[model samples]
Target chain A: MSGVSENRVLAGSPSTGEAARGGLIADVPRRALILLGLFAALLLVAPATVGDYLLSVMILVLYYAYLGLAWNVMMGFAGQFSLGHALYIGLGGYTAGALFVHYGLPPWFGMVVGAAVAAVMGGVIGALGFRFGVKGVYFALLTIAFAEFTRILFDHWGWVGASSGLYLPVEYRDTDDLWLLRGSATMFYYVILAMTAGAFILCHWLLQRRVGYYWQAIREDQEAAQTLGIDVFRYKMIAVMLSAAMTAIGGVFYAFYYNNLYPETIFSMHRSIELMLGVIIGGIGTLFGPILGAIVLTTLGEMLTGLTEDLGLDGIKQMSYGVALLVIIVYRPGGLWPWLRRRLGLEKPR
Target chain B: MPIDFLLNILVAGLLTGLVYGLMALGLSAIFGVMKVVNFAHGDMMVVAMYATYTLYTAAGLEPVAALPLVAAGLFVFGFALQRGLVNRFINATEHMQFLLLLGVAMVITNGTLMVFGPDARNVQLDYAFDSYNVGPLIVDKVRVIAAGVAGGTALLLAAFFRFTVTGKAIRACADNFTGAQVVGLHVNHLYAVTFGIGAACVGVAGTLLLLITDVHPHLSTDYTLLGFIIVILGGLGSLGGALLGGVLVGLSEALSGALIAPSLKSMFSFGLLILVLLLRPQGLLGKQA
Candidate 1:
């Protein structure tokens, strides 16, 4: 029962408080709704209250939360382990970035186009793997293979600037250009915040629906799900496609926010690892877990960076991060959200 | 362009493949026993390589002379890692196991970066520039010696598995986890020992690699994927398959680097992997799943 814990937890309380009943805000228990409402209000005013630097950090936190939420749809929900998620990020970013740079297409339109491309790529990979019944670690390797192949191809292709990297023309301004994704930090923060909140709601909605239940069933036992008349392949494909499409949206933001992209950095195994670290560290398959994880990890990571810089321990910085992660995983393999949920009174103490 | 030049490349590729096989041999052994692909396989090897490099530089000990000490040290490190950290995750989800090993790899890799300062270090032996004349082929002396040493180590590993009681116990555990446990085998201790042996094989391979390659922290990154590719290509748990897969991959690299662009060499390997995975997922010599 690798995922039985998640299934049990999600069944009792999918997102915030315990309630299998359907409907939005009204369906949530009084306490969770209040807490979520307060959290949302805080985020809405955060841009104005926080300094520019902290605002930027919050933007990153939201961005990572969005990425984690997107990734969780596939792995946490569907139990399909994709280790080469950077492939989708690269696909989304490059698709949008290339279209904008070369053809002068607006990023809003490019985002849609990027999502389609990413979905197609994810479909191809999922088909290759699922059709052959390549599950577990071997399936993970297949994802990496596709990602590495794409990276190599991009490195050699000069059309998208090749290994020299792709750069987007930026006109920094106070006024926001929503169409072009050109705006201030606050504007970007709101965009990512919207995406993260929307993704969380969408996941919660899905989890309580037929599709979500099917995904959980499939996750818990594929053979059992198949015997119970579930179209295992179709649901799995939906998970892959939906996750890929959402991840592409994050990639679109990454391209514009960073204003430059290198194939190596974009498709590197490092990107894939970091993208899932939030979900893994947070409660996998839980609604607020990715959000909590994104905040804790990004904040702590930033703190670690500053602390190391101040103490002249910069060299051992990553080593320290690695060691800390090990300790955390060893102590809380189920994730930090469950522990925090008890304190928050979201769930009864066992 | 010339035939002799082609022959030289072929010989060189085969020699390099032998070393690659040795590196993968260790990885395959670990997976054979534990069924957990040691994500830190390459970095653990890097630890041995760095130790070998230090021996050569600090005390003027030859890499060959210090091989035994370095291998033994890696064995202890691997055993301790399994017992202390990885053992907990043996029964955990695949994702947890992957994350745990990845954390270990990051620690080892970044720790090396911190200590080694990211400089690419190399060894300069007397015969570094020398090669042997074998008819139309001119093979590097260092490559030949390294290959011979690798082959010899592989044989020693075989004999260890075949003859030693501890080695036999480890093999039995791999064959049947519950069966071994039912027979009153110390499974945890045996698992640690298997991990240690895996690390030692990598230690042997890394020392030989230090003879031909420049040592660097980042070198560990490429080797992890490379080891996985070779291990998969050979056959999941088959030692002989790993060697054969290594040679094929090595030759592919050589041929592709010589004929096509060097950047595209990895592309060829991945392509071959996808093809094999589709056609025969069991690997070239792997038993039917």
Candidate 2:
């Protein structure tokens, strides 16, 4: 497998191994860390200078980055292509929102509950799908069916406001309530940043672990992974559960940060596609690819919307996105990040 | 309560199944010929529907009357798309190809959204509302014609595949691409031709559907999902499988709607899909994995 060869090269080189084995080592890419730190610092401080609209866009980028990373774990790493990841996100949002609305539970607690529910749901889907040996596009369709089913069911159920949507009561004083996750734009920015950071760390850690190696093996060739006694099913399930849990947290962040939850909006297939667009256009199965993709795509989307508003070329956003996807698939199927990595001499040829 | 009601449901189920079968035919053909699940099948149907609608509204022609032109146009379109766009990713991994198709589907759908807008349009025919009473059961004339058209198309497709040289070549290519290539078959042309046929089937289905229902840009998602379910249920590349699966799904939907709530209709089909996947895995009529 390609990843196996890449892994051997990365781990086999003693100098690189020593650098990667420890934090802040001399062999580590100091420029990359410095750039990342600089970016983080800018992100943290930008809300002060940026307007509400820009902050909103930033929030979307962070959200997409977070969701993309979560999705990448199952899809890019574990080779499970799920089309219904919005199921976890929607479930997470709804669970937390419903708990808050009905039981008046604090959002921090509700978030945990939401993540747990998503994890369980992921487990069920994983067990049923993997146990029955539903592979490839069939498994993807299965996930879509389940997600759509849940969406329809939730759309019908009125307790959490159903299709009408659930709105978080806007209390002026509640903005200061960190427990409820209610805050101003700056606070929300920091919160989403922290969440994005957490997701990135989790993904990085997982990618560096033994389980990551197993996942790569399974992804590259399931039969080979099985022959190597990698317990494909278990690892796949673990990836699903972890991915779901992370996505559920994103859902919670969405609900609280946005202060609204709509079945159609949260659980829509469009949302799933949006989540995938970032990863696909950036680079699937690569660390930080989703983040870069999210940033680029979101920025482009915002720019397109702005252009439409200014120049009045309606529907250009969708057209541009279509064109972008086509161009990427045709010219650089591995996506912009991988292409950039090669161009910049960051990625060595096999 | 009455026999007529049951008969009406049965008739409705059969007609619906025919439409489903037509939709699945294209998907099945693409899958069989190229081993590619054309997720854009539904979008192609949507595009055909839009074309039919445009012809109907602007040219003042009946959708059924416009079927041939629309089918021919879409045949060209599908051929061009497959040859120009899809052929590039044929050598890529299955996952990449799937994503590529998905991206293409997205482009088609969003492009439709841009051109047609999100408003729903119906191909208004004078005969749409005209129905006949067969004893106690009321049968819509349009639906009956649609069923007949669908069945005829399916039969014609079956015959074409069985008898035509290009069709045989397509089948050979599908069965073994490398072997067929070695045997002097033009695999690329065959693929484009198969995709064109698939798109043509969707065109026919779209025109017929316009006779009974409305068309929307987003309706492709539902059709895609339904076609996917039927294809899976029928076995991926089997025409007979698609037909049987479509009928089964249509009947199940009808019965479930009759026995349960209308809202739970899709849930029933989904549940059946899960059960089938668990038990058979190869689908009811699919070849062994």
Candidate 3:
């Protein structure tokens, strides 16, 4: 089946032993290490040098990169595709936003609740979905159903502003509120950058462990993984929980950064698709793929937006993205990262 | 629970549910043969609505009168889409199928938005807003006609699938692609025809929808999701199941909108879908594959 082989293509060249033998950093090729260092340096310095407008764009790129990495843990490594990831984002954002607005609680504390709620939601979905043996496209549809249900429920909820939408009051402050997570563009950029870095390191560490191998095995062939006594259900649940909770953190960051929440916008299928594009474009299972994808997609989208606006051609950007997705699926199914990996001789066939 | 009120809801649900059934029938048939979820289905419906609206506005034809032309146009478009774009990825991964469909959906919706703008347009006839009383219960005149048309289409589709050689071939292909190929069935042609028929069903629905409501670029996404729920509830690849599932969903939606909040109608359907998936993964009327 194509499902089995797509994961095989990802797990093909990289032998697990290399990544497991030390930390991810310890086993990295020297060139990749150098590139990682250079990239880190660039991220650290960009906020300082870039203008406010560009800083905002950088923040969005980092935000997507962070979300993509979290999602990659589930879809890429674990081979569980969730098409309704906006559930976590919407839940997490609403939880944190409601707390701040209603109770005057800071975002730091609110993020804990946000992540917890999302993890619980993930746990329920995984439990119900996996226990019943819903897999593949059916599983994806199940996730969409849950997200749409939640979105509709939230739209009718009064405490969260119903369909009118919830907006946090903008108290103009010159300085960044570090604890409260209220800040200017530069401050938010650094925060998102740190989050992206944290996610990368955490994912790298996780992928080097037994759980990562179990996930790959389960993803590749569930029956085979079960034959080897891999406890397939538990590992898949772990992936879901981990991915959901991490994405919730992104939701919290998004809430504070944007200072608004809407059931339609936050929980829309459009949001979920936008979140997954980076990983799909960059590379699904590769560690650095989401990062590269986030940068490439966000940059291209912004450029297209600017160009289309200048030319008075509305919706050209969205059409381009759709066309791009179709083209990529048809011609470049392995995505940019895998192609680059082969071209650079980073992953040679055994 | 006034008897008349409940009866009115039941009547309305059955009428609208017939439309939903026809829409889901097309979706189910497409999945039956192709094993691909057509995410662009709703967008195609919207396109049909726009086409019908254009015909009605330009030619001064009634909305319902423009149904055949729109259905033919969409059938050709669906046939071309399958023969050209989707055929290449028919054997690809399930993930690829979803991405391809989603991409097509995005392109169609955005392209329509670009061309038509975000404004909602509707074709209004004198009888559209009128209602009729049959004894104690009242029913909308437009809904009655829509229900009749949808039911007629479904019956015609069922008869075609049951009696025609092409329909048998399409079903055979759905049952087993390689087996059908070995049996000398042109699987590709059947696929194109099945997709075309599905799109044609949506065309009929789009035309009917223009009578009671408005059309916009994003109108079809709601229908798309509804179609998915109906298909799943009826059982994937089961035509009759989609019809029954659509009725069940339509009835629940109507009842909920009447008794509970109108906004929660879709939520109710989604909850039912999740419940069904958890309890009966094979669907209510669907046989286990």
Candidate 4:
């Protein structure tokens, strides 16, 4: 999406733009291959090199990156900003967790069910909102209201343990119960890494297709896209459903990894914001922006936590998030990707 | 429920509704002129609450007495906020405005948390607990007085918008940003003024709220969400609509809390919001989108 937009935006500088496009077209496959290689190498080598704590942090980074990618598919690619994406996460987590806990279904099956459930939920929201011509902030608010309603519903639904939260058994009997989702941090880390890599590849594939072009067109201008023979509504719905399904996978991972699901934490507005922060800071509408954003934010967050712990400041984490977002939005609204691309001389004309 | 009990609930709901209206008025006003939803509005209200709390705690002023000072303080804050941050993105996309205001909200809420240490603070007035019995209803003195102030302010705002030149200018901007610009309206100044007035409304609400509830950094989101509900229900930018919407929401909440579980009150309101969006997208009094 960013690629398409950047071409039009940077067209003002014909030379640089042309050069950048050329460079990008040449660089795309090579960059992808290199990134995959590096990721694989890191995946293989990191568990051995880093301590358990660091491994856990890496897992968190990957998890967030995956979620950010899912969110980016909707807001960045389709330009349908959903403020309550945590709805999908929560739905997925609860469904998978409940199945695992109550029905003795393995997370392997539960995860798929969770994803389907989230997709359906997303479909309902998108249908109701779009069918009624709700757009802009109204659409955003509707999403929020739905999320809040679900949160409240979950809060009272005792089957999910109500507000006390649904807890999954964390007793590790065997370290290699892959089907059951019982494993070491290393096992979970590897699984999450696969998922993150898969998500990135999926986004790349989608962005390369006709659907991706349609999404980008709709995002750039809905009316123009419709006039150009694009089914804006169907495309938007697909974007939402796909995004929700992907987010559900993350939620299932979270449920098993964290071994607990609370309506408050899972469905909180803060959770939605956290997922979006990565996409926003990294670069919306770009393939690797969410990954880059996840890394930077997680590293900064850890550093801030450590600094605050050392200084005995209780709420610096929240404060820092605000300051960072403000600085990014005000000074670098296009986010770090374009700037990073320029700095690295990777600004392709294609 | 018995008639008297229902009546009591109605009175209580109406009082709280008036407060909600005042809480939402500033946001409505700001949206009217700028068409931007100020996500930081709740945090601004928290700032007002803290300001009022400080006045009462440090200076021994009554919460009601501290109202003007808090209003003035918030007015300045809102003015500067619009001029410095919001003005830059005034013409930007709705998403940009949202992110900007969200950033502002985060800064204000977290900044307050850092400074105030997450402690809940409230001023204690002697008459806060005092109540008067009328027929079969009991009304707390603080709430009644707060309700009166809220009602009075709503009326004043209505008159201001109706008669005052500056208010009319703000209205003009709300009515048509481009047309107002063509007519030589100082859109920027009017935006700042509108935001200031909105902040002042929060100031008034904050003062009244502090009499009954504690001020905490975490509460800002709740206030912000509630304010959004009211604004949406009332129709964005309509003063009377805000009041009406607030009353309806407040009544719904109170009745639900009494008739159903206390936990479901918020859900009810949020559900109503979804219903409204689907059924009546323009809201009760809002112009057709």
Candidate 5:
């Protein structure tokens, strides 16, 4: 019964949504594959060409891109705005880091548990919000409340080092330890690059599947989808849970990469906002949009820093970021990806 | 807990809540009229505080003395903001609106930091340590003055909205956007006026706040969240509700701080916000959706 409805939804929407997808599927698969191969090859050898500082910047860009992809699953695809997504990142990072720090467990083992925990957290938020018929901004507020409440709880909970912070043992090794997940910056960079690629593929596959169609239908109109026999509560829950789980994996990487976690910084609203900025500025719900956004935003931010540093300005870089964001949002509400597609004559102009 | 000790906490909460009520009122007013959440609500208030600070440092003027001047400045600022930037996005999606205001918030915060740096700033007040003793209850003089001033502004705001022609016109617009347009109301001007009033209210609130607490650019986000929580608790559009909600939070925070760890006070406040949101989202005095 559900299968028939899923097919109906799939057949019904994307025939039109395909155009709105920023011309992702409009491209020939062969061209996309070639481009993907070239992009991946360049990233693989990027460490050799770029200096350590540039490599670090690239890592940040990719890291945020990974988070943006994870966040896009719930927000962009499903049309559920989560203002407190930092909660998932903090939870996953802390859970995995704590397990590794306290019990000497490998991060791979810890990440599984971390992802599960984040999924459950996401589920709880979904159940409470969706069941009560909270929609749009109200739902966003609910997420923020839960995230802040959790942050405060963690702030006082002595188990995770309370407000002081959680730190892991630093191992300066020349060789990469894949099992322990401790290694050089190059190793970490490769790991994150691989993760970013995986996230994009996973999103693409999900969009092709039945669930993705249901999500797009729901995002377009919840009531209409419900009238069509789609289970609204369940699909929304799945999106939230899956997104949370993926973000937690990023969290595990963040904990190991930073070697320390503070509830203050990790669970901050600023972090939540920063992660999604790329998605909004690039192309929302588009697979390659976040990657491009990450690259543009990070590079722009670096350039601004260079300009601001000579003048020794305290917050000018941030002000420029704010100004830049406004300009992009005002000029390209459909995001840079769709705009780029039009410029390259790959997609029709809106 | 001893009764006097409890009363002391209660008094403290009430004092803090009065100021919070005024701040939330500013946010609620803008939201009520425009139906758009001012994400930069708190940052604008912080800007008002800086205005007050400038008046103090440059001319040795008291915040009380500079209140009207700062509020007028904020009114102009808010008016320009709504007319220039926010007006373009009124018809846009909610996501775009949020992003736009978040951008505004970032610019305001960073710009303030660029000019003032990160250090906390304060004024040297003559009545800083003075207190009033009534029987067994002791209250700080500065807090009482701040609270009193905040309460007065809220009253003035309520009266303005209730009695003034422009205020009624704004309310009519809130009641029905298209009808107001059909009736030939200059909605854009009214919107700018409503936004200016909201900003001016925050100016009043921020000035009073500076009388009691120190000011910095980063404190604005906390205020923004606090305002939202209060407005939600009191009900979204109700002027009276915002005050009630503010008092509730203030009392709860005071109680939690005394009963639990001081750091966990915000946990209780957020907990109440969640409960209110989940259980009775219309808020204590809000109209049903």
Candidate 6:
């Protein structure tokens, strides 16, 4: 009944066998260094070369890239597909924003508190959901339900300002308030860039470790992985916890950077879908795919919006995105980054 | 609570449950026969609603009068979509197929949004607001009619599956695709016809829904979630399960809203889903995995 033999047949074939073989250490490290250098250079040069609109777009790209990486840790690497990822982001934003507004806590400390709260929430949901044998689409639905529940709860709760929304005091004059993270878009852009880099490195390190291998095995075949003595529940819970914590950080960044938090907007299914879109369009399991996806999607979105506005066509951007998604899935299911990597002779042939 | 209030809630809940059951029937039929979860099922319903709405507005016909045309139109639309597009990925992994359906849903939703913008529309039948007396209770005439229509459709569907050759072939294919193929069943045509039946069910449900509530482009998500929950609760591939599950959910929602708060209605349903999944992974009427 279990498709273990089918999996073996599919995985052991030579076409995929090459993919399973880890690259040479020299080539891997060299590629890693090149990517790192390129990123650092972009960070330093982007602010000067790009205008305000482009800078804001870059910020969004970086934010989404960070989110995509965070989500991939759970969904792609660990094979736990969560459709309610906005729960973490919403929780994180509300935590930090509420604390900053109510208690006068600095954004830095607020961010940590937010992340911790999100991780704990993730742990509880993951524990309950996994323990109850909710997997696959059921698990996805559960996550969505939880997120929606949270949104509704927050919508009526006035302590977090309810549906009217919460606004952080923006004192542009206090540009040097690094602790509170109140500054120009340029300053916040750098902060997000730094966070994105840190998250990327963290995910790369995690994926290279034993836990990563355990996750992949579990994802590919949970029953077989369990038969091999792997603690599937523990690894999955950890993946969720880590992913939630990381997503919370992104939420905190979103709150302070935007200086606004709306339950409907932040905790929306749309935000979750947007994050997943980055992962899907980039490449699910690949290390660099999320960032690539975020950049490409953000750029394409901007272009589409501009084109629609220029042509005086309403709702064309969304339609274009839908068409793009269809074309991408039908033609290049492996995602753009992996396809490009294969084509460029940078990675081993599929 | 007053006795009349309780009775009213109960009646309303039962009627809504019947309608939900009708909607779930399409999903259940498709799943039962094809083993594919059609995420776009709700969108098809939306399409039917739009078609019905257009007929009501343009032709000045009542929703009930437009039902047959809408159902037939949707049946053809669904048959073509499934035969032309979805069948290509029937052999793909379930996860990939889910994604594909999600993509299809997005395309449909966006296309509708582009066409209609973001406004709610309702089919205004003069008699929709009418009421009827049933013994000591007064009920909305439209709701009673919708429920009757839904039950009749279910009965007719049951008969079709029991008495018709193509319907039996569909059931046979659902039981085992490979065996059905080896036994000389036209698997492809059966699949398409099964989908067409499902779509027709949704079309009927959509027309029925327009009698009681407003329709909008975004209504698809709420209906999709509700249908999925009902189908899952009823078990994956059982028509009776869908019917029973829909009634249960509808009753719970109504009772919860009457007893607790209106905002907690969705939460109650979700809680029930989790509890049922935990206690009986196979669902109330589901076969053991």
If the candidates were sorted by their DockQ against the true structure, best first, what order would they fall in?
A: 3, 4, 1, 5, 2, 6
DockQ of 4: 0.63
Interface RMSD of 5: 6.6
Q: On a 0 to 1 TM-score scale, where does candidate 3 land against the true structure?
A: 0.96
Instruction: Say what the interface RMSD of candidate 4 is.
Output: 2.9
Better of 1 and 5 by TM-score: 1
Top DockQ model = 3
The residue ranges of model 1 lying beyond 4 angstroms of the native Cα positions read A1-22, A310-317, A348-350
lDDT by residue for model 5 over B188-216, one digit each (tens)? 99999988999998999898889888999
How well does candidate 3 score on lDDT at residue A59? 89
DockQ, per model, reads 0.59, 0.49, 0.71, 0.63, 0.58, 0.38
lDDT of each: 0.85, 0.82, 0.86, 0.86, 0.86, 0.82
Q: Which digits, one per residue and each the tens of the lDDT, describe model 6 over residues B1-289?
A: 7898889888988998998999999998988888788888888888888888888888898888888998898889879978987787787766566666777777777677777767899977778779988876789999999999999999999999999998889889988889999999889988999889999999999999888888888878678878888988999788989989888888999998889878779777877766666667677898987
B-chain TM-score, every candidate? Answer: 0.97, 0.96, 0.97, 0.97, 0.97, 0.97
Q: How do the residues A120-203 of candidate 5 rate in per-residue lDDT, one tens digit apiece?
A: 999999999999877777888889888899898788778889889999999667888989888889999999999998998788
Candidate 1 per-residue lDDT, tens place, A1-350, comes to 26325434433344433344545553455677778899999999999899998998899999889999999999888889888889999999999999999999998899999999999999999998899988888888888888888999999989998999999998857799888888888789998999898998899778777788789889888999999999999999999999999999899999999999899899988788778877777877777878988888788788877777755544464575567568767877667887787678766323
Alpha-carbon RMSD to native, per candidate? 2.2, 2.5, 1.9, 3.3, 4.1, 3.7
Query: Sorted by lDDT, highest first, which candidate order results?
Result: 3, 4, 5, 1, 2, 6
Clashing pairs in 2: none
lDDT of 1 at B151: 88
The DockQ-based CAPRI class assigned to model 5 is medium
True contacts kept of 5: 0.74
For candidate 3 chain B, which ten residues in a row score worst on lDDT? B212-221
User: What lDDT does candidate 2 reach at residue A188?
Assistant: 82
Superposed by TM-score, candidate 3 places the C-alpha of residue B184 at a distance from the truth, in angstroms, of: 1.2
The sequence of per-residue lDDT tens digits that candidate 4 reaches over residues B125-197 is 7777899999788888888998999999989988998999987888889889899999999989999989999
